[model samples]
Target: MPMPHILGADHVVVTVRDLDASAAAWAKLGFTVSPRGTHSPHLGTGNYTIMFQDDYLELLGVLTPTDQNKPTQDFLAAREGIERTAFTTDSAAGGAAELKKRGLEPLGPVHFGRPVDLPGGGTGEAKFNVFRWPLLENPGGMRIFACEHLSRHTVWIPELMVHANGAKAIARIEILTADPKAAAEHMSRLIDEPAIADGAVWKVPSGGRRADFVFLDAAAFAARYPDAVRAGATTSGAAALVLVTDDLAKAKAIPGAVTTGSAVSIPASAANGVVVSFVAR
Candidate 1:
């Protein structure tokens, strides 16, 4: 069963070195990138969001050096790509408390907001309350966090939902780990969900209309995404992001995208280290 306060997958944070350049790169891939939004001074970060129906992707970059952005800076020092994934929660505090009950220590119920330019000629604050799983306890070599959107309207703008690639929602997130079973079990403990074994892969469902987290060994990952260009030299961590699109033809038309049977994939080198694949829903 899922955690009481924890909903499902919310968004994935792709840490990039250059904010504007990364946004332009995703735009070239046919995604409708949102206007840049800067976080509060304490956070020292800015981002552009690729909005979908329920979940989204955040292109995050450091604007100034601060204690809060140390982890992000460290990750960027190595490579740019998905540094962490967030889960949806109605109450960050409640989620944290539940995590404590499960013998896992959560980081914080941090409060922050970004200024958003509303489509109807007004400005709004996209507020959020978030709490993270222990920083050092990176399951499947990726950080996990839970987010509570205080102002959903400011974040999920309808104008930003349309994409030229016809992408609708995140279908799945694939992680390559040395021990798929161990990785899946660790994630299961964090999310309070069961990890089901399927051949060489282990699947952890995020519940609702969200994506599943699939963990597999290197060989299985290679077999699954043969044409994908991995981001870093490391064999562990997030491997691919698959999206459900309305039109496969439009997705295949993206510059530099390769058609792998029924799916169209954008190389990780172009997408800040995460292989992006599009499949018709």
Candidate 2:
């Protein structure tokens, strides 16, 4: 059988210039980020740095000063900004195998494990069994990486480094891309999901749980959504968003929150655009 469309967004990776600062700020907001780690010789190049979560946010940057030096300056050159969205799928075996049949190459079923300490001082560890697979044919364009969380500890949101709120819901993602229509058709056919478009916006939900991406013209969308703000999104090419909250008053009380507008939002639109709305835990 064909592989599943998405198991959920699994985790989002952002390339940042300052790991400590970003991790600290997000932690203050409740996300649990792991200590910084250098790239493994196994991952090729051995020049990457990362932070983790079962369902986590990867803060990638150069590993050391030498890696940050000259010819390699681009890697650390102030993060003029780079962001990529990742989709976690149901079957790594089936997905990778199937993608290979379609002429795509997947990296591995490699695993990543790390120790984690909680805000209350309790400590534990987690493991990640992952495989990097191909989605779009373009080498550096878009891809799918399978991830499994092996944290026997805390109640963290497996896919995100963000705290587990036990929120029973996930929002859809709409990607604004160069060829929304084609992307929609390809993804719909590949994942067996119904795809539609209103111009160049391709929309699809992470096969399992919940998460979606719609690719469209960035400028046009900001205008259409009107009250959107891209606060804590991946620098990745794909657009990330959070919608207006239903209770601005309530959301404000939450720490680390930065309100954008006046009107409140429904739970449905929590991650709809580029913002943070009061969502149910």
Candidate 3:
């Protein structure tokens, strides 16, 4: 069973050095990027979202130095890529309570909001309550958090859902690790989910239509994403994001995209250190 109050994948956060540059890069890949939204002053961050049917992607950048954004600043100093992934939660407070019951310490059920530009006119606040599974509790080299979106409609606007690449959803997240089994088990325990052994790879289903987290060793990751994998790349953390696209041709048409078998992949060098692959629906 899944963790209490935790729904499947909500969105993936890609920490970037330049918000505008990252947003433009994603737009070049055929995604319809949303207008940049600045978070509360205390958070000292901003983001541009790529909305999907159910899940989405956030390209985040540090706007100013703040104690709250230290982790993000540290990540940016090293490299820019997938910083964390958020799970949808019915209630942030309930999620934290469940985590405590599981013998895990949960961070704050903090409330924050960002002003969003409405489609037609005016502005709206995208409110959210969130709790983290500890800053250092990075399972599978990726940080995990639960988010309760109080103003969903302000964020997932219908107009922003359409993409030129025909991307519909995040199908899978690939994590490269020295030991896939251990990484998978760690993630499974954190989420109260089962880890399925798939030959040399391990899979943790996020439930429902949400993307599954696939953990594999370096060799396996290189074999699966030959064109996307960089030489001597970090052996762990989020390596790739696979999206289900309605039109494979459009994905293949992206500049610097490589087609291998059924999927078209963009190397990490071009995608802010995250390999992006598109497979037909």
Give TM-scores for every candidate, taking all chains together and pairing residue i with residue i: 0.96, 0.64, 0.97
Highest lDDT scorer = 3
lDDT of 1 by residue, 1-281 (tens): 78998888999999999999999989999999988999999999999999999999999999999998999999888877889999999999999999889888888889999999888887889999999988977778889899999999999999999999999999998887999999999888878788999998999988777999989888987766664445442467886899999999999889878887788888787898898989988
Question: Each candidate's lDDT (Cα)?
Answer: 0.89, 0.46, 0.90
Q: How high is the lDDT of residue 12 in model 3?
A: 95
C-alpha RMSD of each candidate structure in angstroms: 1.4, 6.6, 1.3
> On TM-score, who's better, 2 or 3?
3
Query: Which residue window of length 10 is worst by lDDT in model 3?
Result: 227-236
Q: Is candidate 1 or candidate 3 better by TM-score?
A: 3
Order of models, best TM-score first = 3, 1, 2
Q: Supply the TM-score for candidate 3.
A: 0.97
Model 1 weakest 10-residue run by lDDT: 225-234
Spell out the clash pairs found in candidate 3. Answer: none
TM-score, candidate 1, is: 0.96
lDDT of 1 at 82: 82
Ranking by lDDT: 3, 1, 2
Error of 2 at 134 (Å): 3.5
